[model samples]
Target: MKIVITGAGGQLGKELLQLFKEEGYMVFPYTKQQLDITNRAKIKEMIEKIQPDYLINTAAFTQVDLCESDIDKAYLINGIGPYYLACEAKEKKVKFFHISTDYVFDGEKIEPYMEDDSPNPKTIYGKSKQLGEALVLDAYESSTIIRTSWLYGHEGKNFVNTIKKLARHSLEMRVVHDQYGCPTYTKDLGIALKDLLTKPHGIYHVTNSGSCSWFEFATEIVTFLKSQTVVIPVSTEEYGLKTPRPMYSVLSQKKLNSNGVSLRNWKEGLHEYLKKEDDENGH
Candidate 1:
């Protein structure tokens, strides 16, 4: 089967490319230079050329703070881009798989968020993603929207890499303890997406089981690296930012479970990611 992945240079897109290649599928991974998703004409041109059976969109304007300041760019990339891709995919009779985020929720619920939960985004980034999800679902009934959270991998500028860098260079670090969510390894998510492609389509929450605060995640990184860096736990007020992050964005995997596909715990996935990074960098 022919598969097309947008944001080919991003961490998740790269992992998907690797997984698809290993699975012996004809995969066309397109970076921003190859095909700009925000441009509807370009998106149509590329999809027409590839004529893929599935279009897995991993592209987005992910800078949360930047999105708060630059709402236009955020909507263009995160909202309109996915809308255009879904329309083209529907016209071509291809299954569209659009990756979304847990930020779609307002973080008010104490329990894990189920798929049927109504979204009340508190940030511009979250609002944009919610718009994207709505557009894709409205345009294509066969589309699969996977809402994930705290994504990281061996490659990319993510929380794990940031913590690792700080541990390597600084004597101490302050991380937010109030905000909580599941940390998803991109490679595992990539494999999960590949598996989901073969199954029935619908909305699914695919993240590694379990949740943790940024402080806890940072502590784990320091422990794994055997670093002496002291990770200080701080509340959200102490680490105040322009964008208001979800205090609890833990997604329930009951939907993926119902589909008979769920990933392992976040810590286990983190261990494998760290090991892979160490091996690749000759650590």
Candidate 2:
């Protein structure tokens, strides 16, 4: 299958690109510099040239705090960009796959969020992403939307990398405890995406099974590395984020499970990541 992946420079996008290439599929990757999805003319031009069977858009203005101050840029890139891709992909008869986030919901629910849950975004970043999901579906009914949470990948800046770095230099680290979500590995999510290639096209919640607070995730990280750094749990107010975020955004993977694909636990994903890092570093 021929696939065109936008946001190739991103963590998840890079993983998807590598996975597809290894599977012997014809893949075209575009970094934000190469393809600005909001530019309708350019998006159309490039997509026409590729004529891909599927267009997977991972591009978004994901800086949560920055998005608060730059609402226009957030909506333009995260909301309108997917709309443009959907419009063009529809004309080409190519299936559109969009990566969404758990932030779409308010995180008020104590249980894991399902695909059909009503979205009440709490921040500009969440609103923009929620808008994108609606726009893509409205533009093309056949489009597939996958919502994930707490993503960390090898190719880009993520919680895993940041924590690993901090553990080495800092004597102690403080992480928020009230907020909870699944820590998804890009490699695992990439494999899940490959399985969804021929499945029904609609919104699906995909994440590594189980959930934890940022404090727990950080503690796990240090434990895996045998670091002496201390991990302290703090409340959201104590953490002092510039933007409002969900306190509990764990997503339900029931939809993905019903589709006959299941991701392993988040701990397993983290273990695999550390193993890969060890191998790469010749440890």
Q: Write the per-residue lDDT of candidate 1 for residues 166-187, one digit (tens) a residue.
A: 9999999999999989999998
Each model's lDDT comes to: 0.92, 0.94
Q: Pick the candidate with the highest lDDT.
A: 2
Of candidate 1, the 10-residue stretch with the lowest lDDT total is: 238-247
Q: Can you give the TM-score per candidate against the true fold?
A: 0.98, 0.99
For model 2 the local lDDT of residue 94 reads 95
Candidate 1 regions off by >4 Å? none
lDDT for predicted candidate 1 compared with the true structure? 0.92
lDDT of 1 at 96: 94
Number of clashing pairs, model 2? 0
Clashes per model (N, Cα, C within 3 A): 0, 0
For residues 1-283, write the lDDT of model 2, one tens digit per residue.
8999999899999999999999999999999999999999998999789889999999999999999999999999999999999999999999899999999999999999999999999999999999999999999999999999999998578899999999889999999999999999999999999999899999999999999999999999999999999999999999898888899999999889999999999999999997897788898
